[model samples]
Each structure stands twice: as C-alpha cells, then as structure tokens.
Target: MHGRLAKSFKMFVLVALCMSLTLGVLSGLAMAQEKKVIRCFVQAYTPRERMEADRWDPPQYYWKLEQEYEKLHPDIDIQFLKPIVGEYEAWFVTQMTGGTAPEILWRQLGAAKADYVKDWYLDFTPYLEKPNPYVEGNDYWKDIFIPAVSESAVAPDGKTYVLGVDIVGVGIYYNKNMFAEAGVTIPSTWKEFMDIQEKIESAGCTPTSFPLGGAMSNPGSWSVRLLQDMMLDSKMMEIKTGVKGAKGVVKRTREQGGSISWMELVRAIKLGIYSAKDPQWQEQWKLLKEWSRYWQKGFLAAEDTDAYRLYITGKAGMLYDGSWQVKPTEVDSLREFDFGLFNFPKVTEESSPYATGIECPSIGGAGCAAGNFCVPLVVKERGLADETIDWLMFVTAPQNLIPLCNDLGSFAPALKVTEGVDPRLLPFIKQLERGSERIQPDLSILTPQYYQQHYRILQQYIGGRLTMDEATDKLQREMEKGADTLIDQHPEWGLKK
Candidate 1:
C-alpha cells in the first residue's frame, strides 16, 4: 500500500514540473512577440537565400550586424525583406498607398525620388546632423562620410534622405592572357586606347564587349557622360552655376572635380551656357562614333548581359564594367584566363582639340554605393523611426562597413576612416582619389526623363540615323525642354516668369 502511494505521488510531481516548464516557454514566447519588428526592403547587400545556396563564403556580415544590433536592443527585431521581383517602384507605391510599406527601402533615388519627395520618405538631414553613438569620436554623423558621398544624399530641397554605405568605381576589365598574347599594354590616353582595341581586333578577338544598346540606358549613358565631362572640363566653371541669388554657394575652381546641382544645371541650360552646339560637345560624340567600329557587330542592339557574355566567353578582349563585377568574375568558372582592370583612358588633345587635359572626373561617386537606403514615413507612423535610424547608423559605422564591403568583394566603404579595404578594390580607390569631382553638363543631374531622351538621341546619332548637326540641334532643344519642365514644376524657383 505504501509502494502504491509513492508511485502516485511521483506521477503527480512529474505533472506539476511539466506544467511549470510549459508555462515558462509560453511566457518567453509572449515576450518575444512584444519586440518591435523592423522590416528592411534592402538590395545589393541583402542577406537572402544567397546565403543558404552558396556553399562557400556566404556573406554573413549583414546577418552578424543584425544579430549584434538585436542583442543590444532586445526589444527590437530586425528583419530583412526579400527583394520584389518586378517593378519595385510600383510595388512600393502600392504598399505605401495601403499604409503598409516596410521601415527601410532601397533604391529610392531613381524614378521615385520625385514622388517620394512629397513626404513618402523621411528627410534624414536632422538625423545626419546628430552624433552617431556607434562610432568613436564621431561628433557629427555626416562628417564620417566622404564629402561627395554625404553631399549626394541631399535632395533638391537640400534635405538628405539616403545614407550611402559604399562607393562604386568603374574600370575596363581585360582578359590578362588575351592582352599578353596581343602584346598590348593598358592605354593611358584615348588615342592609345583605341589603337590597342584595333590591335586586339587584329589578333582575331573582338576588341570590347562595350554594349551601347539596351532598355536600361545606363551602359551607353555612363560612358557618354564620362567622355563629355572630360571633353568639356574646361567649361565646367561656366556651367556649375549654383542657384542664382543663393547664399554660401562655393564656386568650384576650373580644375576642381565635383558635381553640379540640378538647379545650377537647369539655370545653365536656360542661359545657353551649356549648349549642345558647343564644339567640345560635338567632338565628344564624334569620338564615340569613331570608337564604335571596335565594338561587337549589332552592338547597338546588344544588352549589357550580351556584352558580359562575350567577354566571359573569351571572344572579347575587354569588358567595360564597375567594381561590382569583381566577385562574379572571380567565381565565374567558365573564364579560363585571368583578368585585370584599368581606368578608362583619359581623353587628351590627341583625341580631341577641345580636351582640357584635366583628369576625367570620377564616375564612381556616391551613386555607386547601392546601400543608399531611406526610411519610409510609415516607419515614423509606426513609432519605429528612431530605432531605424539607430540601426542604419550602426551598420554604416566604419568598423562594420569595412567588413561588410570586404566580404562582398565589391565597392569601397564610403566612410572617412575605412580601414582594411579589399585589395581587389584598391585600383578603384585610386580612381576615386584621382578625380575628386565630376564635371557638367550632366543630363542625368536634371532628371531620368531628360537623361533617357538624351541617350535615345545619342543612339540615333551614333547609328547614322541623324547627322551631328541634326543631333546637336535636337539635343539642345531637349535641354531647353528639360529646363522648362523644372521651371514649371518648381514655381518656388522664382524663375517661372
């Protein structure tokens, strides 16, 4: 009878212990549910399924940063949302219209910049002025970035919206084995660059996979801007007219390399200071036409991917691309020969009589950094604004940014004190340092609409559908139209009359 009693008591004790443990688990889960979830719709540096699929060297720095941030603020939960597959702007607008946009958004600068400027995105100027607690001796958050990078975050209204985390540098990537076999060295001048292309073509290889045609006009547009900027460098000071009657406008010296404001560019166009009929402008296009012979046949219709494939397949001697291609090129198993990169050869008097011989301004500016993310106004509505800024500050801190960029093997950290930059990116860093400022008249600085129009016109000119005089006349008219559009949009510019 005593033994029976003992067994019954033991069973009762087991039931009590199980109930206690179950209650404890339920309590823990309830606490976890209370955490404020921050959803990040990020790009380029996202820690997505790529982490799981890559067998070697999964980029875990972003994950690590999240874990560390969560540990520091246990009440906050950071979640990175997967990228939307198509038309991100449309989806973003839909989500925002329904008041359900994520806390952090990526690539808010392109077509959506104009729309989002109407309070869809939070202005980061106030936060950028504050000290970032994550970085040592960082009294001001804005001081940590390269000046050009920090300046890039500012919108037309002079309010900063995005925080860029990395810098992009462009170079001409060449198959080292092919270059050696052709007995050609990296060219220093535009003339020599073309000469080498001819030699490479003579060696039975396509000179370059320089794609000029695509729905995405960036590939063609980028080279044109660089060449135009170089050819017209002597006239930049005349064109970079900051907002008329604005105070504290720092006039750039003739040799200074930097960007001009859209207002300044519009004003320049309206004043006829940046006319397409300018000989320098005409020469830039002529030189591009001259070089088109070395590009792959049907180059005008080739997409960016087509150019990349041509280079990777060893049929093309060189690939014109940015630093972002490093990791993919390194890992591409199909590329049997080693590859090297060099900056676009500078245009000199030998190439164009209008060449100022001033170094071509750096193409890889603040825009190259894909980490230019912005917080939605919805995040503020959800009372998570401060937390989101804190998270951004932590991620952008030089200590964290360096490793993140290095792990990706692309782009240099855009911090003032970045250390341990990837060796592969050293050449790009040199390029950035070589040209501290970009020149104008940059159609891109105006608007996506005008830039697209300009690129299309350029394609027509290069394809022999239009004469140089006809093209320049059309281009000048487009500039005038662009200026008129801006003037109408912003009556506040006080120049509408």
Candidate 2:
C-alpha cells in the first residue's frame, strides 16, 4: 500500500511540470508577435516643459496624434526621438551616417538636397499619387494641398520627396497706436512706404526694427520682402519667365525653361541675361540702402529676437516679419498695444521696371510652406515606408491639422481649408490669397552658400562699409561662381553651356 501511494505522488509532479513548460513556450511566441516601433526624429521647436504642460490639450496636436495613432494602430508603436536643441543637424548627420536614422525625419530647410535626397530620402511620388486613407474617400492625397505647394514639392526628377504642412507669409506688423500717433497712412507705393518711415522716425519712434545678426546674420524678412518687390520688375519677371526681350531679357536653352525655373535662372546668369550692372538691379540696391537709414541705430548688429522685442515694446513703429510672428507677438509677448498687418507696398512704376498697371506682386516670402517631414530611405529597407507615410498623412489631414494650426497661430495650413483658419491668422491668410502666382524659390534653395554670401555683402552695404557698386559686383560674381559649381555637379540640370 505504501509503494502505490509514492508512485501516485510522482505522477502528479510530472503533470504539473509539463503544464509549466507549455505555458512558457506560448508566452514566448506572443512576445515574438509584439508590435513594431517606428522611430521619428523631429526638430523640437517648443520647450519640453511647455509641450508636457499642454500634452493633454486638444491643440497639442503632436502628442494628441501620437496617442490616437497608437490606439488605432495596436500593432505599431510610434516614438519621437528628440535631438538636442540647436544640434539637430549634427545629430541627424551622425544618425544618417551610422545607418540608424529615424524612420521619419525633418528635412532641413536650405540644406543641400544633393547631399541626401537620393541616398537618404524615400521617393514619395508613388505614395503622393494615391488617396490618403485618412482623407475622406475618393480624393487623391496630392489634390488636397494648395497648388503651388504641391507643384513646389516635386523635384526636378519629378519625384515628390517632401510634404510641407503650413504656409507662412511675410508682411509688416505695425504698432497701430504708434502709426496713429505719427499720423502715417498705410503706404501704397515704395516712395510712400519710405516717406511713412521718415514720418514715424520724426515722431520720435524708431521707424523700423531690422535684424542682421546671428549665425547667418540674415537681415530678416524685410530684406526678402524688398527682394521680392524688386523681382516684380517686368525685366526681372521676363528673365524668370524666359520671355524674349522684355528689356534686359534672354532666350532659354531648353523647352522646360521659365523665368523662375532654377536651371533657366542659372543659365541666364552664366549667359549674362542680366548683370548687377543692370539699372533694375542697381535701383533695388539703392532702395534697400534708403530703407536702411530709417532703421534703429546699430540695427545690423541686432539679432532677430532683439528686433522682435523692440517692436513689441513699442520702441519701434513697424516690424517686418513672417506670419509665424503673430502668435509670439500678440499672445506670447503680451504686448500692451494693438498691431495691424500690411503687405509691403507696391513698387511704383516710377521706382520699378514693370508697367504702371502692374500691382504689387504677391511675394510668398521664405517660409511660404512650413518645413516637411520626409521618410529616410532606410525606412524603406526596413519595410516601414508604407506605415511611416500613412502615419504622416494621418497627422496632416484636416481633422488633425486644424487644431495644430490654431494652436500655433502663425502658419496657415498648406491644405485648402473648407472651413476658415483660426480667426487670428485670417489676416495672414488674406495676404497669402493676394499673393502673386509667380512664386520665386528662396535664394537659399538654389545655393545656400551663395545666399549667405549675398546676405553678408548686403550687411556690409547696409552698415555703410561697402558701396552699392562694390556690393552689386560682389553679389553677381558670387552667384555666378556658385552657379558654375552647381552646374558642374548636376550636369543633368542642363545649366552648363
């Protein structure tokens, strides 16, 4: 009886061991089937503390989208990899070189595309043609973007690589009370604009705030606004459009050439279509110099933040900045005075080469569209391209985008709004609506190095360190040299003779 009882106990122990082993094997299999994590790296423009505080807010679009996306996509985990402030480009380069780049990354504006576009970014052309699953049924994804934005995103190779999210326009933000106090009317012509500046200055206020310091020493949006005005000249337009003999015009070498076509412009420079010696070019410099006199003393040494502060404090009468400034100026700065928006005035026929009937060309300044999010080529190798693109589209859809735009306050959505934008941003939207269809790519787009060189020259001229002749000659030479280098590198551009 004792032997039989012992045998029964052993049998029970063996059964319990078998059950434990089976459970362990099943758990392992479940773990193997867990969701894949998609890594994204983006430039963090907001402070972490601020983002965290607003994380639960409806307008905290980035965080909100992340939570919603993960909930909907149970099989996927999205992670935003934040780089150190001001060191994103460095970190991005390291990641790209080490073959560990995030699945989605921010495309650095003004960076040389040749450095990464072919090797690092996925060609989004195929994806852009398809309908966005996040959009309402039956609409193509590409159709939703504003026409200029859609067209601008396409590369010379006809591939769409970047998807911009917002439209930012540059305009004057003037202190309403200061303008009223000075009795200055909103200017309608270049002369009137300058005259208003003088009037404001005489009223004991700095006429305008201009910044030309920082890493690039960029002369802020005002300078670009001035350039856009100058570019509206009929001769400049003709050169950009490839029209034959509209004053200082030239012929195009290729059927694809237009007045503003990148290659055409490069060819025009190389072929001497128009030089710095041209009367139109000299006039632009003269106008810029004249405008400089009305700026705050030592304005060239001031940074963007300095200039912004001056205007917000009511020390300066007008600030020429991008639409992105609206939120910061009105809400963030908590200014005491009311401000009004105005387009840079029309360059009168007396001051410009264009015909009398031509109105101020709607110049979409530098940040016409917010920077885009691009999928790194490595994401495709890892088989996450579809998922990454889908995620981007989901975030950019109207339902998600509107809240983001409302929160930011400055940028208008790149997607057409069936409903109105944030009321605060309507003024900017109105300006964008009035913009000329003849969009000119930022000078940085063609050659960032040359663009910087031109800015440096402009700073010197503005500070009275260089004569207009010296500045113009140097600009033309630097541009030509940069064009030559680019042509050599991109022979397919058809810019070389």
Candidate 3:
C-alpha cells in the first residue's frame, strides 16, 4: 500500500509540470496577438540579411534600435519589411494607390512630387512642434535636428511631410596615392583645380571619372549647376524677391544657411532672370565642355559603376560622388590605395568673369537627406499612424541616431548628435555646416519635362555633336516653355491669369 501511494504522487507531479508548460506557451501566443504591428520600409537601412547580401561584417544598427524599441514598448511590434525591388518611384505609387503601403516608408517630400498635394502623405507639422518624449530636454521635436535640415523639412505648402534623419553632401573622392604621385594638393580655386587635374593626367592617370551621359548624368550636370549658381550669386536677392531693389523682403533664414521660396522661383522665371538665353547660362555649359577634357574616355557613355570601377582601380585620380560612397569604397577588399575627399573647388574670376567669387554652397539642403521617413495617410485608417510616428521619434532621437549614423558611415546625421559618429564622416559634417542654400534651384527637378530635353541638349553639345549656338537656342526654347507650363500649373503663384 505505501509503494502504490508513492507512485501515484510522482504521476501527479509530472502532470502538473506539463500543464504549466502548456499554459506558458498559450500566454506568449496571447501577448503576440495583443501587440500592435507597425510595418516599416527602411530602404537602404533594411537589415543586410533581409536584402540577402549578409556577408558584410558589422550588422546594420537599425535592427538594434528596432529591438530596443520593442523592449521598451511591449505592447507594440515593429515589423521591418524587405527592401523594395525595381523602380522605387513606380513601386511606391502602386503601393499607395493600392492602399497597401507600409505604415512607415523611406521617402522624402520630393519623392513622388505630387503625393503631398494629393494628400497621400501625412502632414507632420503638428507633430514636429510637439516635444519628443524620448529626447531629454526636448522643447520641440524639430529643435533636436540640425537647424538647417530641420527648417528645410517644411514643404512649399508650409507643412512638414517627411522626417529627414540624415543629411547628404557631395564631394570629390580622390585616390590619395595617385594625388601623391602627381605631386598635387587639394585645389581651392577653379583654376588651381583645373591645373591639378592637368598634372594628374600628365602623370598618366585619368583626372576624373565624370559620367555625363547614359544613365549617369548627375555628376556632369551637377558640375554645371554648381558653376551656374556661383555665376548667379550676385543676382540672388533680386531673383529671390523678384525685384532688383526690393527692401523689407524678409530674407528667409536657414539657421546659418538660406533658401529661396518656391513662389520666388516662379517669380524669377516669370521675370526672365532664370532664362537660358542669358550669357551666364551659356558660359556654364562652356565651362562644362572645357572640364570634359580631363574626364575619363567615353565619359558620355560611362555608367556610375564604371566611374567607380575606374577610381577604385587607381586608373582615375578622382571621382565626383556623394557621401554614400564612403561605405562600400572604404570597405572594398580589392582596393589597394587609400582615398580622401575634398569639396568641389570654388569657381573664381580666373575661371570666368561671370563668377561672383561667392563660392557655390553645398548642394545638400533639408530636402536632401537619407533615412527620410514618411507616413501614408492610409495608416490612420489602419490604426498604426501613432505607433509609426512614435517609432520614428524613438529612432531619430540622438541616442539612437548616433549608432545608426556611425554604422551606415554614409550620410551625416541630421540631428546635432555628433558624439561617437564615424570619423570618416567628420569632413562631410564640417562642409555641411558651411553650406548655404543654392541660389539657383535645380531646373530638372523643378521642371521635369524640360530636364530630359536639357540632358539631351547637354550631351549633344558636350560630345561635339552640337555647336554652342545650336545648343543654347534649343535650351532657351525648352526653358521658356517649361517655365510657362510650371506657372500655369500653379495658380497660387500668381504668375498666370
């Protein structure tokens, strides 16, 4: 009778243990079901393994922020979606139209151009004015970011629609060993810059891997745009206010920087200040043609990757690229030479009489940044908008931003969070502060239709297929038509009846 009782007691103990384990599993499942899901599409910041290229060391820090946020908010689940494949613009449009967009997406205000006006994106103005709970001593959400970048987030409609977490700037990435071999140093003026390139070419290396044609027209076009802005520096205030001696026009401030209003751009175009027929405009193209002599052979057809290959192989002395190149270029295993970056040299009177001697400001502005997250208007219906924004605020807080920026090693952080930032990004940060708004806006973006024609005309002129007179005539006609179409479309600008 004693043996039977002991055996029965052991059986009861095992049954109770099994029941406890089952109950624990059920509780976990219930918690998961109760948690709210916030879908995110982080573009390049998506985890490397999700993108299926996981060989790189030092995992993406975005995941760390996601995990930390989850730990803090047990009731919420952050679901980072895979990076979108194919053309981003088309894919984004489809998602929005289908009402299937992630709650949070990597998009800038200018991504779709019409999305803001169509009310597809949420207006963030109200939220920006509020303090971020995650940030200590945060008087307002906007105050924590770099002043210029923060201010620039406001769209022309006077509303913030995107949160730019990091800023990007462009500079010349040079092969340091090649520069040493050529006995040249960084150039401060356009004349000196040209001379250095000549010396580098004399040393039997391609001076620059500048692509102007095919799918990579930005580098070549950017050079022209910078020079044009430099030439027009003296006319900035006049163009900005639409009058030569306009007073009390309230010069818009951007921290230590400045920017032209969209209305002012329309006024300038209507007043013919931005006419392509102007001699200054023609001179910019001439300067581009002159600079083309130092570019790698077949620059007109070279792809961006081709330019990168040339520079990395040490056959080219310099490559004009953005801050984004620092990551892959620095980590490349096959690169044998060290590299350094310097701002594009200033255009001075020596290069052209039209040059105002006012150096071209950095091309990047508030609108120009990476990790720019935007929320879809549809997220409100899905009951995820609040949680989505909360996550954005958490990640953008300086404490989290520092690690992400350091790990990305590409863009400069939009916030004032500089502690522990990657040392390679220091130069970019210094230059970004010195950069003011461009006096001349990029016409291609402001007027998309004319840009295609403009690119073609530039290619013809630069490749020796069209004369300066021919190119300028075609460009003038296209520019005038483009301006008219833009004015007509925006009745609020008062440029059209």
lDDT (Cα, tens digit) per residue for candidate 3, span 119-173: 8888887888889999999989888887766666666567777777787778999
Clashes of 2: 5
Each model's lDDT comes to 0.76, 0.67, 0.76
* Candidate number of the best TM-score: 3
Q: What is the TM-score of each predicted model, taking all chains together?
A: 0.87, 0.84, 0.89
List clashing residue pairs in candidate 3.
none
TM-score between model 1 and native: 0.87
Query: Mind giving the per-residue lDDT tens digits that candidate 1 earns over 1-497?
Result: 99999999999999999999999999999999999999887677777545554533645578899999999999999998875889876887788778888898875343334554567778888988899999988888888887766655556566766666677778889999989999999998998999999999998988988777865545466677778777766666677753333333233321113356556667777776777887766877888888888888988898877888899889899988888888778887678888988877789898788886766556655544567687878788789999999999999888898898888777888776756887887676666655534544243456557777788888899889999999999988877887888888777776641
What digit string (tens of lDDT, one per residue) describes model 2 on residues 313-429? 888988887777877776644478988888777677666564343444444422234446777778888888888888888877888877777776667777676475787666655
Q: Which residue pairs in candidate 1 have backbone atoms (N, alpha carbon, C) closer than 3 angstroms, thus clashing?
A: 257-437, 258-437, 258-438
What's each prediction's clash count?
A: 3, 5, 0
After superposition of all CA atoms, the RMSD between model 3 and the true structure is: 3.7
Model 2 regions lying over 4 Å from their true place: 1-33, 44-47, 51-59, 87-90, 108-117, 217-232, 237-244, 247-259, 350-357, 362-371, 434-442, 492-497
Better of 2 and 3 by lDDT: 3
Rank candidates, TM-score, best first.
3, 1, 2
On TM-score, who's better, 2 or 3? 3
